[model samples]
Target: MFSDSTITENETRRDLPAHLEQLLRTICFRIRVQGREALKNYSITAAQFDLLQRVYFNGPQTMTKLSQSLGIAKSTTSGLVTRLVRDGFLDRRRDETDRRVFTVAITPLGEQVIKSVIEMRVRYVEEVIKQIPEEKITLVHNALDILYEVMSPKQH
Candidate 1:
């Protein structure tokens, strides 16, 4: 008998809602694996590097704002912030107006590194897109636009 895992064989046998779920799963897996491989020379994981880029672009941010923007828990955000600060990529300071509020900013070195990483990522994306046909690229762009419309958050 085959031992059951968290996702049972029966669950796997059942039809998925659409290919979208499988496609997304495959994309996530491939991207994560390849991204790690690409980041081997970097001291941080791809995700940590991505967080650093976000902070460089839009920081001097509070813990809550960072958490929200990064779609992570506040504790997780704090941990990331601590690690970045340790890496000399971030500076943490109390808000001048609010003693209770802590904010994080990217270091100058972090900005330069992040800019390079962003360029590398853009080049990688361009290379991937180069494999697709022009018509297909247009279709993909249109589909993404529709997807954005469908999935956009509703304003209160």
Candidate 2:
């Protein structure tokens, strides 16, 4: 039951206990921390890693797009982009068709980090998953896949 325990389970989807939601959020945060630790020698922050991921997967982005995607202010995005540019991890160039607009692209160095970060994170998760029973692992994998598909926003 939720919403002061008055809402009936039949009123909506299965009752989602608040703790389960918090647990999922906590797991996500912990995994990101593990990734940050894996990147200790790269001198990059978690924010930078996340931004690099978004750009790497989605391609070059305008400052406005970056800010909106990263859920940060344009000024803050500027600082992050400036730092990445200074460190040779990202490049900023003016759009040829629209001189007033600027776009940011990940550099080779950034690409390398993206691969390493992904591999490192995958390996970390693998190590943890190995602890689970083989049969249960399959169930967990399938369940998580379903959960992701159900919870993720619809693609454009």
Candidate 3:
């Protein structure tokens, strides 16, 4: 037979997953909205920004590799690359050895866009951080650290 406290603890545990899911969804939606606003000044869609970000972080990649990383079809990736190339945000060059394969790299303009977007995001986060009480800041930081550690993909 469970005591009243025991039953309450079990009930809270059962509801925790739903609460966490809602919290994560809301946070992601808010961040994406902020990022979308930042992207508007560059006249780039969020999908285009994502492609540029992948190359910016991972270095140049072939169409196939970019598609795999972006989890989109190769044809779709090709279209994005074409537009970015036309807009001078990305440069595409055929592989010297392979001849047939092309690699896409982010141009200086693309890098600038990425930097500006990141700065905007940082400012937004800073505004939120400023609202938290000084005494609770450490607690909030530690909680975020723990959550990141737990949610991050594990390395083999």
The candidate that wins on lDDT is 3
Off by over 4 Å in 1: 1-16, 32-38, 50-58, 63-80
Sliding window of 10 residues with minimal summed lDDT for model 3:
1-10
| Each model's lDDT | 0.76, 0.86, 0.88
Specify the highest-TM-score model's number: 3
TM-score of each: 0.62, 0.79, 0.86
Q: Give one digit per residue, the lDDT tens place, for model 3 in 5-56.
A: 6667679899899998999899777766775677878778878999999999
Local lDDT at 2 for model 3: 70
- Model 2 residue-pair collision total: 0
Better of 1 and 2 by TM-score: 2
lDDT of 1: 0.76
Clashes of 3: 0
User: What's the distance in Å from true for residue 128, model 1?
Assistant: 2.3
Worst 10 residues of 2 by lDDT: 9-18
